[model samples]
Target chain A: MKRVAYPQMGNLGISVKSFLWELGAEPIEPSPISKRTMDLGVQNAPEFACLPLKVNLGNHLESIEKGAEYLLMAGGIGPCRFGYYGEVQREILQDLQKDAEMIVIEPNIFSIYWSFNYLHGGFVSPLRLYRILKFAMKKMKAIDDLERITQYLRPRAKKPQQVNLRYQKYLKLLDQAASEDRIKELKAEGIERLQELNNPEVKDVVHVGIVGEIYQVLEPYVSLNIEEKLGEMGVQVHRELFLSHWVMDHILKRVDRSSYINAATPYLGAMIGGHGQETVGQAVLYAREGLDGVIQLAPFTCMPEIVAESILPVVSEREQIPILSLFFDEHSGEAGVQTRIEAFVDLIKRRSERSVLA
Target chain B: MRGYLGIDVGSVSTNIVFTNEQMEVLDSLYIRTQGRPIDAVQRGMAQMYDKDGDLQILGVGTTGSGRHLIGAMVGADCIKNEITAHAVAASHLNPEVRTVLEIGGQDSKIILLRQGIVVDFAMNTVCAAGTGSFLDQQASRLGIPIEKFGELALQSQNPVRIAGRCSVFAESDMIHKQQMGHNTSDIIAGLCAALVRNYLNNVGKGKNIQEPVTFQGGVAANVGIRQAFEDALKVQVIVPEHYNVMGAIGCALLAREEVHNGEKSSKFKGFEMLDMEFQASSFECDGCPNHCEVINFKQNGKLIARWGARCPRWEVG
Candidate 1:
């Protein structure tokens, strides 16, 4: 039995672990993404690659060191450059002579044949593969649900860290859950615990919508935990990205595309790839909802987000809402970034206070 | 007798400005940071108040990367980013100012204004090629005082081409040009042009820079860069009399505005507080992957403020 490993992005660990278990492979879990991983990634990666690619590369090498042979990766097509990450990373590892096989799951709808073939070598029964996939989908939904609860409770909890602690507790509980009903029960228990954790101190807080590139928006480390920072400042953060929602709409093709496409049409007419259109859509959505402001966080030199940033000012102007665009890189100063965020929060707060009088 | 105090604690310099109710530059001090922001601020304060400390301060404002630290040290009323502070100062100094080109020691910024309100702004990211420190390094390398470097560049009849895309490349190109027997003045002139092109391409990209453009920050001391900007934009770039300390002046104006806007009293920690022990220190929190360097500020033995951490986990009341 070969062991497969993959990088952690939010709740992918639980989802992938279940699928790999059902597929008859011993899934060696990648260690939690941390400072060591980032350092290793930075040392190994090309200087200009987007932050996610570098960190993911670090995850693979660290996994390989821990005796995991084959690596599992997902690909995205078009201008994202994420599609090429798998092959590029493979070449880099090969050049290092690490002797690891990379199994890429094509991001195209229902394009699981290649990965399944690799997993079974045409020996596994179709029924078993179907069951494994179904289990993975259920786990993904469950993991994403837990995350939604965390996001909802984080800012509202008087003790902001209580939400994070409950999140960790639920994550482990869901990971150990045995059956479908058990998983549902654990989710309910998690929700109840989170409610208990929620503090009643939240009041008249500034509501901010965060929208940007998928990786920067979803991964806390990549964007430097911006949502959490805003929450600590007593701001109600309304993040526009959810792993389950993204997987369902993009991978499962279960949702209508027009819902976002129509909203983004006025500002951004074409799909510019790498969540550019989605960013514009979310910004417009939050603006219309009369949220305090919107924050667009993208990696430096991100082509799609640069385009989105260009159009965001118009959305902000039309909606009469403030917008702050923060482009992150490794060298970004923590204090400088904080100053901008504080100033932005103040700008919106002062603007609202003035409007009440007007 | 009554005035507002603004303190700008930057990476390269700490500046203090005092502005009376009439918006006049009462007294200003600019001193090198030498990597100690707290000490630099103290030195600026000492210099500013030396033998002429009779002005009654109404409010205090702080701006720059170290705004929070200095704000807490002095109990400031308003703490603002350099972008807003620069824009505020430029608009007040030149009411018709449409754009601001601020190239500080470690970074640069372009702030756009309309009808005295900041509409758009951009700051340099990880590149110091077009900043004051880089120019200062080049000046030292050519054995010219930074104050005299611009005057020497003015004498260059034919400027040599130097790559200012990156600081390393620019330095190497300068050396290569030097080895090729290019005049030092010509090389310096070329360097100024290179930086201007880089600033326009990177920091000022896609922004509509209209007249009257105000050139400020420590780099404004260099006439070569100012002329280069003027030549490129085909318009006069105005460098005000107090260009270098504009961030401080702007914060002073803002503090004055806050005072007039029905704020109760100034939070200005008296200048005599400079005699007290105020310090700042940083330590990396190994709590998680981010490894944030939390900065702690103290006045005497008691903690005044803490900053630079992403979370409030280490914060103490």
Candidate 2:
């Protein structure tokens, strides 16, 4: 079988893809998210569906039709719509009468044994899979490190072109290293290169925290590259949610109450019981850490974030922090976001000025 | 001599409540928004100013859907969500109260309180079967005024079951019972019962609804609905004194607290805000595919505030 694996972005997809590759399985390259993919997704998806669900479903469907037999994804159980997505996607594929096996790595609060067994069944030796995973994780960490380092340098780049060029070069190097045996060496070199590019001599700038849903947080096309736009405007960016943190918080830290409860006190109660709790905890931490402002981005129909958005005012009032909640659908625009960010930054600057006067 | 002004402009109605330095309700007005929040707010402000010309508005707190726009127009000291404003009002009135069942003109919300802190709450927005709008529509269709519908329901000897799963279902079911020759009182009481049942199933789902349960909002005035709720839940449903204007009262109380605590002078525009010309328009952001709807407010030909924006990209002048 000729295996053509798609480029994996985060922890879940990377883990699954690496495991499949280790088993001598062929994985077709998933299509890049484009207008055609989004249009197909919106047309097929249920009305009022969240953006992430539609996009991911569209990507999976496109890949499946391109002769990929195994379509892999994750599943959850909750009041949030995420828990039901896997089943809904399965039904949609079935309705389309696709022959691909929808491999769902079910995320349960209790065990990873089922996930391990499923992967092991495909592999001849579990130890070989373990070795592959070990290498994959190191590569993942390196990629994460390189991205974080770039965030620091990107804002201080004298011109927009400089930042864009540096980021593009680093991203290409990281992607090439993902499936290679010399992943560690490539990652280390990339990190060192990125670190060397950023210097403390660059002009100090105001930092803003971006917190919200996974899709809007990561997708530049959706958020209008608000981070890059902000950086171009001479503002440093601090994104609160990252793949590493999400893995640690949702996967490892969630294993026991003693592990995450103290650190995430507000989230300990009833899970809050979705991303609402997560968003609130992050907002509070962002404020307490003395970030200038926080921009919470979410889809328009999202329930958990809406609940968080409602209570965020009280948090803002108490902490004397300014948080802006931005909801995105297909209609969200760049100019609108720019206008709001400018106002927020202006507010922060003026507030600081008043404080200095006092 | 300074007074606090609290304005709650909901989708259906606009309310303005006034209080003295001591947080006493001095004057209040409730008017239907009638698809025009700007006009309703101006009219409400005009009435308040006319009623109390000499009152110096030291502070203003605005709440509800149009709070952001109205607050900016009036130079409000605080702009809060209806949930926070309502909770504050409920807590101030009866600090010991545990739950708030607020059924307004268009929506119904159940707020669960644990020692004055809101622990859990649910709002019924998708379905309007149990909201006051559904009830009003049914009453009007039956050729009975909403005010008398509750009274007519109270006279029913035996209540029938009206399917209140959805407003359309409830209306059809009500008509079916009426065609079967059920008395008007029975049909009206049946609606009251059906709405209570629907609310309990949806909004009160998985909730340990304890007392003292305070029912406030426009719908609280309906005695039949209260009786139906009481009979269904087997608990006493307490209605606050100012049921129709709790949101306004809460906002006023919040304003009073903000003014009393903050050292800076209030941002309130005094009574002259009643005559100010304000307009609001929204446009889609074209910078990205996200296309955020940015609502901008213009006062006297100058944009004062731009809200409903998700990102700060456009905030720069």
- Candidate RMSDs in order: 3.7, 10.1
Worst 10 residues of 2 chain B by lDDT: B307-316
DockQ of each: 0.23, 0.03
Docking class of 1: acceptable
Q: Candidate 1: lDDT over CA atoms?
A: 0.82
Cα lDDT tens digits for candidate 1, A55-95: 89889989999999899887878688878888888988998
Task: Give all candidates' CA lDDT scores.
Answer: 0.82, 0.72
Residue by residue across A217-262, what tens digits does model 2's lDDT show? Answer: 8766556667776776667778756766665667656333343334
Clashes of 2: 30
> Which regions of candidate 2 deviate over 4 angstroms?
A1-55, A58-358, B261-263, B288-290
Docking quality of model 2: it rates as incorrect
Candidate 1 residue-wise lDDT at B21:
76
Please give the range of 10 consecutive residues that has the lowest summed lDDT in model 1 chain B. Answer: B255-264
Each model's iRMS: 3.6, 11.7
Instruction: For each candidate, give its TM-score against the true structure.
Output: 0.87, 0.63
